[model samples]
Target: MKMLLLRYSTAFICAVFIITGAVSGEDKAVGQTVSFRPDKIVTPVSSIIWKHRSSTGSVVKAIEWDVDDGDNIPNPRFKGITTLDQKTGEITITKLTVEHSGVYTIDINSKEHEQRFTLNVMERVPKPEITIEESSNPDVVYLRCAYSEKIIWKKSSGETLNGMKNQDPGEFITVKNTRNPENFYTCTLKNAVSEEISDPVTERELFGTGEDKAVGQTVSFRPDKIVPPVSSIIWKHRSSTGSVIKVIEWDAEDGDNIPNPRFKGITTLDEKTGEITITKLTVEHSGVYTIDINGKEHEQRFTLTVMERVSKPKMTIEVSSNPDVVYLRCAYSEKIIWKNSSGETLEGKKNHELGEFITVENTGNPENFYTCTLKNAVSEEISDPVSEREIFRTGEDKAVGQTVSFRPDKIVTPVSSIIWKHRSSTGSVVKAIEWDVDDGDNIPNPRFKGITTLDRKTGQITITNLIIEHSGVYTIDINSKEQEQRFTLTVMERVPKPKMTIEVSSNPDVAYLRCAYNEMIIWKNSSGETLNGTKNHDPGEYIMVKNTRNPENFYTCTLKNAVSEEISDPVTEREIFGTGSNAGMIVAIVIVVFIVIAVIAIVLSYLIMKTVHESVNNICPCIPNIFGPLDCLLKKTDREPKNSAPNDVASPLNETAP
Candidate 1:
């Protein structure tokens, strides 16, 4: 791992000496906070030292180290404006105000523990401005808001018009006289890294009549500025479509107090005075009301603008009948509007019917999300951006080493342009094979020079050798007017069958089965029973099992990677460890040896008895006594071997290696 150094803090240590005893000052931006702290501090510090290059000529070590005290300087600029951490020996200027922009020095009573800092505080760029560039007609207006790190456009009612949150200039919104006055907008200026100033561009357009009110507040349409006669107060309503409607009529002398049927239940009127009050106001009650005096030519008009709180709009995405097209449907009893990622209106309407949905063709921008904002004649509601569901994917499971392939599910005729891309955080890199509208395309994106192949006819891509870095979503955007789509591809490595070896312990009744594989290993018997393996933090390779005299005890090992698996051949316990039956085998061998010796002795005796019998007459008569028992065996041997002795005799026993 790499280490992050405190270069900023270390530089401050050097700056303290340069400001008091040496010369020179460093520069800093105007709106950024500057802080310096020594890595180590000496305990029981005797004195606190502070000096500014221009304000103090000599070092001032006057203030004593205390938890409750701050800088003691002749210059009033930093007296109460700075904080000192007595234990850490760190000095922080809470904010870089204009008065604190200068070289500063601090010391822990000696030259060895001194620190310094310089502030050149650069000025902020400027508050954001929205310049209206009207087109040929007042209906079409182009607005440019800038002079800030980020530009956000919202209607005067706090409804954001665009979804751009970048450092780039904002996109213009066209007014359609539904959700807004349509052409009027306000922009918020934000400097993400600056230390001061967050302002909305109220001068661009008027959201309300400079009088803002929250929901659930009582509103009055009383004409306190101009008081008319009690008998001449007649209240009338003006519709947004340039029509006049009656509200309530009050004639004090005639005792005639009549109210419109729509406001009969909600409107409260003081009969003694000509004042009308609505208990609760909603968006439906937003309009202009006029109170006229019967005999006098005096009239008072109240734009009784009311606001209501609305819930977040609901949106649904579906794959259209055409595989390449998608439908996004959102509904609100109030007004509904939609904007693309770039802050441009894609599909929207102020009064969308209950069952009607919106259809949109996807754009080639790296971002894939769209927003649905709910609004009324008064206030606007915000919702999180939603992305299209990845309904189609290439059946490629990602891994370390494997081949991945993908193709579009549908194709349109007369294809003019195609944008092939790989998803990334910064932005999707376009690897299109065709970009021109009328003419065809060649290879783009140098990163895929020889690593990928694409079929121009069907837009199918086959990547030859895949690595783990290639594991992500791949997208394709066809003809300019069509919807953009994507397919996910995953790469994986192959794992070969592991080698299984059975090992025997000092005791002949125990054996262990081991496997040699990288990712994972498992040991089992022929009956598919899993043997208890040694617990290892990494991949475990060994498992113990009972070793018996029977040779049928065998183990099987299986190895696996994320995407592939392999199984090993069965190994028997007897193959690794001996059966412990060697003693019995030795006894059988000794019995066979004794039988051979007895047979040889009997054959020799029989031969002598036969010889003596044949020559009894030539020799003595006592030969029968010396070979008496052998004579009987000789008779039996004669029947066993018709031919005296075969030249080559087959062995009676066959021996095998253990």
Candidate 2:
């Protein structure tokens, strides 16, 4: 019974243990615990705890965690929670604040264990206030980004800003604080899990005054007030359209080096002294020049101007004879002052003055030199001296009948008129033909009545139909003062008839002969006979023969005087018709043969007519007088006496006619 009671107790105790183990295994499968800190910031040597728990009753292995804060985080630190373990089972946060308070979770396999913690860390350091020193200086301005604790400066546009710990009260945040009105700056202070932001600070830049001037003008630009330590001063130019033309860069200690396109190779800049010089200024170099002092822009404009020069004057003179009749002309551009060699001033019409042309007349001189002085308002000039000795002897000559001619040494505009006079036998000046022609003129004496022809362009004269009474010694004068030339005139009687002779032909078979009296065919003859071969008889016929084959003969022409009845013989040899010795005989034989043939043809024709008439009479015996004698002869047959023929026949038969 004792062994039985012991076994039952052991079974009951083992059952209780099994139930507990099953419940614990279920808890380990369903529950989780995540470890994290409540606050991250604390003084050095402060108690830092590593706390963790598990949801299941199973014993859990304890693991350590890492810590980080604003000093170790990347730029732009913020208050937030970050997991220390890759499994996100533990978390360590810096500068904890309400922003760092959140529920953290730990993941185990596929299960999550979470814990909500309120981080109560110390407040983060306050952001320092920012201020700009020398905000109105055109050269440079100071910008300060400050905070109560170590703060990081940043640009609103995400630019990493340089920072200095415990900067002086007025020290600038950026090394070269070139201020731009458009830049937005801010400062942020961060502690463990806590951060503070400061309002943005901007540096106000003062713009420099601008001016424009001509390129050659002196330019001087100085600041309104001296700068302390004199930071970098730069010069820049802005174009008329508000664009950057050039940037003037200069070191405060070394000075400036400014380059401009207009001043390329022609301008120099001083690096030790900020001085710019441009030699040989040109108008094209006009533009705006800018000076940039520490990124401050100032500008000035330049302009330029220019002028022209003057020229000299010229003069010419023309002199003429016959002072009272012809005119003298002088031409000049500037104002002219005429003076004679005798220190006498000559006055005349001031024809034209305005640099166009001028003419003066009647300035007569015998031995004086004429000086023409042309003067302008600024200067006075004189032409080369013209002497009267050059005009003492007029360059003109005259002759009677021959043309009176005048030729000047030089061609002068506005020609001078030529004057002419003529003297008669009485030694008195008389006007006969006082008219002007081209190249010459005709001025005949009053007593001269002959026809005179003058060619003015050629200076030629011709006189026609002169009478004995018109003969005389005539003198022709030119230009009045020039000497005259004398010429004697004589008239003659009429012309007589010319002597002449007639020519005749010695051979009868050759050409005809004729005579001309003063080129007039007065008489003509052929062969040796003359049948009324005189002017009174037209188409006179004598003995003439045509040489059909050859011609070789001599002709004799006798001319009888109309008053003396005397005959004059002039002979001419007939030309041979052909090159042969018996040319005359051949011609005569050919003529004779032609005549005989013609006579025989005529006789044969007459015989035929007689036969035809007889035949007609025989055919019609009743027709009266149809045959006349020819028919009558035909009617008488052989029985009729041969003397019974007509007596006009002059034949034996005609004498024997009844």
Candidate 3:
């Protein structure tokens, strides 16, 4: 029975041992799974350890943890798991940075088990530096804020900023704002982890404000503070209607934003240093401006004043022939006065009190100056002096037998009279003729021989039927000056009647006769009866005519003048028949010719003789004996007759002459 109890106990103990062993194996597996542990997490870096026992013995794998920041983190450098010694479960990370901070996961059996731990990176933003740009007027000032990182800008006044990224280095963010006589401005900058602010800056309004800004002058306003990155600075203007006029805007990284129409193409902004320049300012650009930085707002007002310049003045003076009449005119909006070289004002005229034009009369030998003074509400200017010289005496000279006239160089003054004085060749003054003279008793020259007459009121002297002896210089005293002019007389003889002659051609159709005086043809005739021709002939008609059947056929002209008259001897025409005709036929032809010539020859016989003589003179001397019909039949020439009749009378046609 004791042996049976021992067997049962052994069986019971064996079963218990098997059950305990299985439980222990399960605990060891659980312990192995929980063995990996991270003691400390370095920002951006994580570590993990793995413990596992194989069928032969226990083993350990040191693993590095993979970390990732959430949601599209840029610039991720380190990734994946790192392996360590298989015998040890120690894991560690050396480098710590912003990118190494996130959830980490382990990879096993194609499945991922993740462990998350956020690594918060602490970042500090430096204070931003602030600067203001100078403007033509102090009312407007440009502000700039600069920082190191992409920072946020906020205003204390609850103003939201348009966030900027990657602020450029060494660049200024600018804002255009107003400067108030008593106002302070403040700005602030902030980053994801840290924030900074600038000290308050104060500014005063410019003095003396108006619409008329002086050209070529400047006004400046500078703020005192350091600005921060991520902050925006703006320059704005508040209209009377309460509208905000944004002039300029500066971002932490981006340089500036200037509004159109106001600063477009007219303003310049610097990125290296925050500054703005507005060039060529005009009157229309003047206005109030506002400056906004962070959350602070400021205002400054300015007025421009302009000055005026004086214009030049002009003056003119006029004087009359009478020496007493004087006129002065000023062609300007100013006061004028007349003065003399003696430094005294003529006629006691006063400034601005004198008329624009003034006239003075009945004054003698007056010397004066014309002065014009121009003035405005602010200043006064004067014109150069205009002067007039004095004249003591003036008069005119007169000619005999001509109307007495006077041409004075200047206008005559009122109540002034001219005096006349006449002197003879004997140097004695003459006052007697048939006129009354206002002279101290005077005597006439002996050469005058009581033949001279003078009109005192008319200033005329008449010497009837002037002779050669009367030619001399006559003197007349006008005012205080003596004027002498000379005179000469000429005589002419009467002209005699002109003599005239007539000329006729055998053809009665070719030559023309005329009378002329001084080479001018006065009358002309072609046949015995007056022909249609002009007289007063030119020198070209003076020569004798050729190709005449009868040399005596006169082509005569007359010359006449007022002194004398001359006439050429009358020209006569002869008849001839050709040899082919008999005597009876020629005689019959001659009778017919005579009948036809009767109309031209009946007026004058002297004309016929003169024509015959001229015809004979034109023939060659060797042909002197040549008779009309006989010379033609014999073909022989004769010398001209030496003893020619003074007037060769034509044979009577009614009876034949032997």
Candidate 4:
């Protein structure tokens, strides 16, 4: 209980001091956030008021309140920009601008309940830099840590030195520098609001590792010891000619560092440790490097080699004159090897060929994929997977004679070279051409020598007399100084329209549709469902439409061959119906002919009876006579009914008069 009371008393005393002039100011960088309260304990708070005072003891923002006059009214000028916590009386200001830098006071409920917070929002202090200075003692290094803020010297491992942090700017730190290769130190700068750790200052060394890098790259080396009082340090390169050349020289005694004229602008040397950096390294820089420290007493050697970077190799299947053979060609500027997916090496038994061409026989494999690996002294490049299907079966068409052309969407400048290839699946690549702009003409493979023409201006190529075997993707790759163009050429099979017809059988009451072609076929209804039982749809099979519904909107027939598909237009039942049987139509014609004959005979009999009635008056009904009217009436008696003729006797009289 007494300890708790003592803690409260101490805090109360501090609060009283803040109200008086005895409050010591806290450090805060300008434009940084800082918060202070009456204490860390919560008390009864009704309303919160905040105040801002400048560093010069001038009150800037007069007042702010969470609740005043029974309304939660804040100062209207900065309304919604600042907020006060009524419960804790803590004022939070975000995005602290420069003008918000100063002492901040908070009043809880009334002006008497006041607390102070010193805020100075300022920029972060820059990191401290330690540069080596001359030291008389050979084992010690005189160093200065430079910073504008309160600086503290520390070991690079984050260990603080005794009383080193309290030192003023430009003050030097003294320590024994041993021959232990790695001595790293740094400094930390701080203010009320910001702090930063400087870059590490490690003691310079005298030796660097041997390295092998590509030409036109940077080469750097660091030594093991970089202490002050370095009497003389010189970097020398041992050239391939077995002669030593001075690259750079530094002498504490001479008060200057001098570099050799041969490496005037291409070399850089660290003043402290004698390390060297060479930019834009070339073949000439490949040699042994030596650092001579303290008049050659401590020397280290580093070996380096500058080699060329290898270009990536690209693989292409070229068409050979033999329809059953293809050539695998690789394009690169270094050594290359051709390898199949099974890891069998096809080429590269000897040195790498820039443009290597290998004749490959078509082996009827579904997948014939290959890759070309290019290698140089410094690097390796592998190409994309090249396959036979992508080469031979691309575009899936074949014609008797077709013109195949390849063109990329965009052509770039500096056209250095190009390659055209037509690879076949069943055969080898029929044609391959390696076109070099510098060579003025292309040396095409024997097969396509006379059939290929290239347009260098547009990077397009045309091949004439394209046959079925030539129905594959022709790849055109052009090499520019800055880019490569890949054009796709697909040759499709030219197929004709198929003969399709719908047939109906009246006897069986069924419909039969067939897509007649000398190839494999499949029939589909308007809704695209397969007719009959379909299995593997192999090409060149006799396919007919089965189990069909008559009067279909459309029955499409697709005839497929080895490399092409021919779909026939819809053959409706109306167009090809009644060919199977005509019994129903023949019976209907017979019935109609019989009915017409009966009607004609009846009409003639009625006319004869009427004439007889008009001529023989009342004699026919009573007695049989040998006259024309009596004979006609007797002959027609079986054919004409008694009531067959109409009762109009005037017609007969008028006919006789005419």
Clashes of each: 14, 40, 63, 39
Candidate 2's TM-score: 0.17
Q: Specify the highest-lDDT model's number.
A: 4
Candidate 1 vs candidate 2: which has greater lDDT? 1
- The TM-scores, one per candidate, come to 0.31, 0.17, 0.19, 0.28
Candidate 3 residues 151-268, lDDT tens each? 4444433344553333444333333342222334445665555567776455532232233333333333223333554266666655445566776777777767777575565665
**Model 3 TM-score, all chains together:** 0.19
RMSD of each: 38.3, 59.1, 55.5, 36.2
Where model 4 places Cα greater than 4 Å from the true spot, the runs are 1-208, 225-229, 255-259, 297-299, 316-322, 331-333, 337-347, 351-368, 394-658
lDDT of 1 by residue, 466-525 (tens): 776566667777775444456655566777777777766765556666775566677788
Please report, as a residue range, the 10-residue window in candidate 2 with the lowest summed lDDT.
24-33
- lDDT (Cα, tens digit) per residue for candidate 2, span 1-658: 5469668877987987755543211111111222353222322321122222323322222222333321122212232333344333345544333322222333333333232332233444655666665645344545665444556778754666776545453224542333233345777766554467678754322222332333344344444443344455554444435565553455666654545565455455544444455554544433345444455543432211211111333444444453323223446544556676778666646565443322333233334566666654234566666554343333121222332222223322332333333443466665444333354444556443456544433223345554444434444333333333333333322222322332335654455443343222233333555444434343322223345432333333333321122233433333423333355666898999999999677546546787754554443334445234445455655454443344543233223335
Regarding TM-score, does 2 or 3 come out ahead? Answer: 3
> What is residue 96's positional error in candidate 4, in angstroms?
79
The lDDT values for all models are 0.58, 0.42, 0.42, 0.62
- Number of clashes in model 3? 63
The better candidate by TM-score, 2 or 4, is 4
List where candidate 2 sits over 4 angstroms from the true fold.
1-120, 135-138, 167-172, 175-179, 205-658
- lDDT for 81 in candidate 4 is 46
